[model samples]
Structure formats: C-alpha cells, structure tokens
Target: TVLTPRVTLQVVLSRQYGSEGRFTFTSHTPGEHQICLHSNSTRMALFAGGKLRVHLDIQVGEHTNNYPEIAAKDKLTELQLRARQLLDQVEQIQKEQNYQRYREERFRMTSESTNQRVLWWSIAQTIILILTGIWQMRHLKSFFEAKKLV
Candidate 1:
C-alpha cells in the first residue's frame, strides 16, 4: 500500500503479488509519499526470519511509462511513437516546473515570516536598552547628591 501526500491510501495489491510485480501511480501533488508493506506471516515465521526482504524499484515521472508496450498496443508508426514520447516528456517537464514554483512560494513565505519576527525582536531589544540606560543615569545622579558629591 502507498500513502499519498494528500492522505489518500492506494492499495496496489491487496493479495499476494507473487515474486515480482510492477505498480504505477500518478501523484497529483508534489510531496513525500509513504510506502507500506505488510506480511501475513505468523509469529513463529517472523521470529525465525527476523525481517521481511523486499526489492522495490520506484521510477517516477516519464521513466515509469513503457513506451514500447504503448506503441505495440496502439499500433503506432515510428513517427507517431516518437511524437507520443515527446508529448509525455513535455508533460513531465511541466509537472516539474509546477513543483519548483510551489517550493519557491513556500520558501518566500517562510523568509517573510522570519524577517518580520527579527524586525520586531530588534525593536524590542533597542527599547529595553534605552530604558535601562535611563534608569542607571537617574540612579547615579541620586547617589551622588545623597553623598554630597554634586
């Protein structure tokens, strides 16, 4: 099972998928995805093996598509197949660009928030320093007068 970033659960294979299998899924949003595998092994089996071995090969974007299979299924000519490949590549490039834009927007927002906090902190620090200086000056003047030194 795969947990998409959007909180959607996609069950690739509910039953045993044999020795080798391939599953493809399209991501609607650009974010981290979680893959989970569960086995129905009994406690004794689990203790004996200590671990479950899984070989997963994940290919994202256009590489996941089988161009040869597509060409054969569609009975496409060489030129048509080339065109189809180009179109898929272009679509992947667009998705990549959109993801980059999303990251840039998030980074800009964080930078602005940090800048605002730093500006307010600096202002507060300056005010505290000014108030401390005034308090010390008044205290010194009072002490000198009481001692008859001024």
Candidate 2:
C-alpha cells in the first residue's frame, strides 16, 4: 500500500493457499520510507489440503520490472531491446543516486559527531597534562625545601 503526502491506500490481501502477489508504493517525498508486508493464514483447521505457500514481493518506484521476459518472448528487435535496456539503466541509476545521497548524508552526520568527540578528548588530555605538571613541580619543590637544598 502507498501512503503518499497527497494520497493513501489501505490494502487488504486475503490469505489463501498458492497465492502470490506484489504491490507498488510511490511517494512524492524524496526521503527514506518504510515498506512493510504481512502474511497470515485464515484457515480455521489445524491443517489444510497439502501445504500452503504465499510469496509476496513489494517493489517501490522504478524498481518494479517484469517485462524483460515478455519483451524477449515477443522477439523484440535489437534497437527495441537496447532502448528498453537503456531505460531500465536510467531508472536504476536514479535509484542508486538517491541511495548514495542518503549514505553521504549519514556519513557526514557521523563525521561531525566524531569530530566533536575528538575535540572534547583533546581538551581533557590537555587538562590532565597540565594538572600533572603542576603537581610534579610542587612535589619537587617541597622535597628540595625539606632537604634544605634551597
């Protein structure tokens, strides 16, 4: 089911044996979104005739393609096949570009967080070093005075 900013769909699929289906969800919003699917049996009996299997595939946007076989069986010409292939490639490239942008954004945020942590660590180390130096100097002065060395 698709729940776009302007439209929403509440899909209800009946659970039955040997049933397979696919659904597409298109969103105008250009960000990551969750796509979910649930499958359940409605049979009341402990067991049904033989075994039941349901396969559900959910595809979003341009990732949905079930036409290559059809095109091949129809004996499409080389030029026609090339065009279809190019179209598919374009769609795939767009999807990949979006995914790359998402990853880059995530990586940038992580880099910022790591930089802040490193800055704090450096400050802590400097404070510790200064405190240690001061303590050592005071201890050495007290020892020299106790021994009347100056």
Evaluated at residue 57, the lDDT of candidate 1 is 83
lDDT of 1 by residue, 50-100 (tens): 867777788888898899999999999999999999999999999999999
Worst 10 residues of 1 by lDDT: 6-15
Itemize residue pairs with steric clashes in candidate 2.
none
Tell me each candidate's TM-score.
0.82, 0.51
- Kindly give the stretch of ten consecutive residues in candidate 2 with the minimal lDDT sum: 5-14
Candidate topping TM-score: 1
lDDT tens per residue, model 2, 53-137? 5465656544565566757797888788778877888887897799789889989999999999999999999999999999999
**Root-mean-square deviation of every model:** 3.0, 6.8
Clashing pairs in 1: none
For model 1, what is the alpha-carbon lDDT of residue 3?
71
